[model samples]
Target: MADSSAPVLLGCDFSSSPSRRKPVVLALGRREGLRVQLTALECFDTLAAFGQWLAQPGDWVGGFDLPFGLPRELVQALGWPEDWLACMQHYRGLGRDQIRAQFAAFCRARPVGGKFAHRATDGPAGSSPSMKWVNPPVAYMLHAGVPLLLDAGAHLPGLHAGDARRVALEAYPGLLAREILARRSYKSDDRAKQTPDRLIARNDVVHALEMGQTRLGLRLKLSHAQRDALVQDASGDSLDAVLCLMQAAWAQQRHAEGDALYGLPQRFDGLEGWIVTA
Candidate 1:
């Protein structure tokens, strides 16, 4: 049985605009020493539903697959507020069209490969630029996700201060997946692209996590059914959520060792929040 006093650990695979077909997926779990157990997986078909879930009373720590802050260079170049909270507030007011226009203008002025300004964490975490409006559209993820965290009163370590009972960290599941799979593709949203090779890759990733083969030195505990479910999902959203859950477990361990920043580096940039395990 799980400890009654342990805080709930969460890993979220978010979508900026969620629908029944592409909902935000959450992997709920708990940690006992170096082992993290997969307890449940839930999906919310709308941002409002997800936000409601966030506001519910609970003791939890979550690793969300969304940028918590914008890049410092981009914010400064665009003449936005320098302080993290103020900048987020400023960003929240703009329409999506306005945001796209401004970001597009910023990119058009620069060269091809280096057009987008990146958060310091992006390089180490191997994540897409937080300001990119296309492809992954992470800028909108930040836009839609951060406000929900803030409104829920979750503490964000280096960024905004909120409820101590609830903590939120920016996490990138790709970081863990790459450590195991090493660029072998594991999933796809497009039905036509879900090949057998990807299924094998997903199996490899799940095996690595179960065996604690990653650098984090934390093993994942899953039942036989749970293991099969993770491997069978072609979109990889559930597996991505599990990856974030492991990151959250690592952060919780750091907290237990008396690091209030929850495994984030001491020299973290306030404007460009650090990825938890990076």
Candidate 2:
């Protein structure tokens, strides 16, 4: 249902360090009926360059793989500043050791079973706890990622400020990957788990998306060579971006259906909405 005339749906797979490696890979496309055309995939080597791209005026809905905010309970418990930008600035000033120490202290004070606090969006998105540092390291991801969006003046659907024409949504590739190969670890950026089977599994997920098996009911239309390129890229940046692109497509479709904020459900509770394309 996305407006066929919209320029493009932008999806980003973000890297904390854009300089040392391919920091961000973006997939550009839009929905056409049940298919998402893959117009281009580009990688950025620096946050500055990515920011430049974000700053450019365009009609886009994007699914960015980054945590948007901290849990309200955690913020309150830490007695951090209530203002979002102020709190993030305070957090950014702390060294990793400091963050770990403070978070550890909080955990020690809380009951073992309730170590992490939940965000209002969690119940709806089924996202990992925002405080979790390992496995997904979403807490750190949020810490590293949100400020960039804020600095870029991007609009987060449920969490931050931005114009309606350009939208941002928090998206997790793990959610989509797990849907098909549940219990079977498919891919990992960690070298230890980057096995042949995991590579194949990544391919399988890509193929499924191309074949339209995802919950969004949209197929990714990619060239055979592009598919091969995505499969061969061990970093999985392109694939992750494509996954985000699909989410954007779904959001745009919902927007076209009259949801001003795209397809984000009305009752998010604690979970923050991922930015989606316009």
Candidate 3:
């Protein structure tokens, strides 16, 4: 366990529309030397509740699974604001159908194989374009999430500055999950698709994290029960949140090591936010 006075760390698995069945998962943890202690996992059953949590004043840093910004190409094609904050404001003003139609028209103009516009960081991060409105509905997520962070006064490292004491960064758990499991499908929202092999894969990923086998070089300290909880959730929400927690820990370490951007590349695009590990 970390010292009682250590600043809190949060990892969020967000949803555009959170529900009792698919609630937004929040993992709370702290770094102790080289180990990240898993302290608690909570679920916000509604988007409003999640925003309410962000609204509370807390000295903390966070890794959020939602995309913070749209692709530069998409934003430019739509004639949205070029500045990150202004773009978010413009984006929040539009409804889902308008956002989707704009993005679809942009895609129609692009080449077939490259239907989606990508961020510079997307090549390495293996994340979907933030403008994607389906599959993961990340575009809607950005519309739902970033505004809440903005409203709560949480600083987004390279994207937006809010509370200096509270920092939020875009995090992609797939970046870390791939390091240990490769192409092994470890999680699925479909109950029938959650097989035993994926179960073992989740266990394997957690074990590797506990042993500090990845580039992050931070071990996960979990009680036996906590370990089970991370491995048993076949949907991977809990595990993804923990992976994001590790990413947040990495960013904090970088900030402490004199990297002012907290692991973000010095030359990242202001309009297309970079993923933490990318």
Reference-based TM-score of each model: 0.99, 0.86, 0.98
- Show model 1 residue runs off by greater than 4 Å: none
Give the per-residue lDDT of model 2 (tens digit) for 68-105: 76777788888987666677788777766677787778
Clashes of each: 0, 17, 0
Q: What Cα-based lDDT does every candidate model obtain?
A: 0.94, 0.75, 0.91
Best model number under TM-score: 1
lDDT of 3 by residue, 180-213 (tens): 9889989999999999999999999999999999
Most lDDT-accurate candidate: 1
* lDDT of candidate 1 over 1-278, digit per residue (tens): 66769999999999999999899999999998899999999999999999999999999999999999888999989999999999999999998999999999999999989999988998899999999888999999999999999999999998888999999999999999999988899999999999999999999999999999999999999999999999999999999999999999999999989999999999899888999899
TM-score, cand. 2 vs. native: 0.86
Residue pairs in candidate 3 whose N, alpha carbon or C atoms collide under 3 angstroms: none
Off by over 4 Å in 3: none
Query: C-alpha displacement of 195 in model 2, angstroms?
Result: 1.9
Off by over 4 Å in 2: 1-4, 81-98, 123-126, 269-278
